[model samples]
Target: MTLDFSVVTDVWQSLVYGTLGTLFLAVAGMIIATIIGVLGVAILRTHMVIPSFLVTAFVEVIRNTPFLVQIYFIFFALPLAGVRLNPTMTAVLALGLNGGAYAIEIIRGGVESIPKGQTEAGLALGLHNHEVFRMIVLKPALRAIYPSLSSQFILLTLTTAICTSISAYELTSVGQRIEAETFRSFETYFTLTGIYLVISMVTMWTLAAIGRRAFNYPQR
Candidate 1:
């Protein structure tokens, strides 16, 4: 059957609003994840015993599980534990925690990739553990794994589509609503695909720029 572009066009405003929701949720979750990931990695790297093991276990469980199941756990399972969250908050927390787990591994790899000599050199220079990590190690680590981190964030954005199943009214969720109302599934989804593509591309580009500037890689 032929597609009706007009139906999709008519729904553009609603889709834009929904896309904004998707972007907001993704960006907010990513910010939280970044904080958690960095702190989690720091804890693993520095702590001597129990905290490190617990963080590692948490990371492993989050990384190994299916994200859909995690979301469901946050939304449905939590209510069973006498904790209730709105769908949006549930989606944000679940996505953030899941992404943070993956990011911890990515960032820890960067941290570990640093030369042993670098740490020794920092120590010899009278730099303490925190200073060594903060100054001598952190920038190089970020520069080393920034590309990987960016890819993960892009993947996280795409995964926001899954949030619709929880009735979060994200871009995909709104597009599904429009499709049901207009009976123009092809047009609705195709337009949605384009919007997602643009958003992902823009987000990647902006993040890459920030990464480069913040890390200040060597110029050719």
Candidate 2:
């Protein structure tokens, strides 16, 4: 049997919007994830019993759950509590919370890898503790975790496809509509897979560029 990508090709404009939507969800989610990751690590380091325990609990819960169930809960279950978020917002929130959990641990590992001497050196340099953390610790720690963080973010981007289940406007959702209308299941999903592969590559390239710019310190 021959393939017919023409079904997908007939609606290129919808595909563009779908791809844009995916990027929007991924970018917004990554922003939230980074914020949560950084904040979670900071709170955990403070070792305040209550805050630390809450952060730990969040990490454990999110890390252990299925992402599909999490998204469904945010979209379907929260409305019962008067927390009504549209599908788009719910999808972004789900993706962010999911990625943030992993980010917390990834960043913590990087922070722990820094030698204590570096902190001592920063302190001796007449810098405030906060300044030392920002200037000396944060950058190096980010450099150490850059690879892992980038990979996680890439996975997060791919996860946006699952948002289709919630009717969030993403690449896979668009493909589903096309498939339903065209009755081209094989062609629709095959092209969807190709599009997703492109997205993954683009995301990987963008992350690599960011890492280079942010951590391009001279190697000793």
Error of 1 at 6 (Å): 1.6
Give a tens-digit lDDT track for model 2, residues 1-220. Answer: 7888899899989999999999999999999999999989888877899999999999999999999999999998999999999999999999999999999999999988988999999999899977877777777898999999999999999999999999999999999899999999999888888888999999999999999998888743
What are the per-model C-alpha RMSD values against the true structure?
A: 1.6, 1.2
Candidate 1 off by > 4 Å: 217-220
lDDT of 2 at 115: 89
Candidate 1: tens digits of C-alpha lDDT, residues 119-193: 889999999988898877776887889899999999999999999989997999999898888888888888999
lDDT for model 2 comes to 0.92
Q: Each candidate's TM vs. the true structure?
A: 0.95, 0.96
Q: What is the lDDT of residue 118 in candidate 1?
A: 91
Candidate 2, TM-score vs. the true structure?
Answer: 0.96
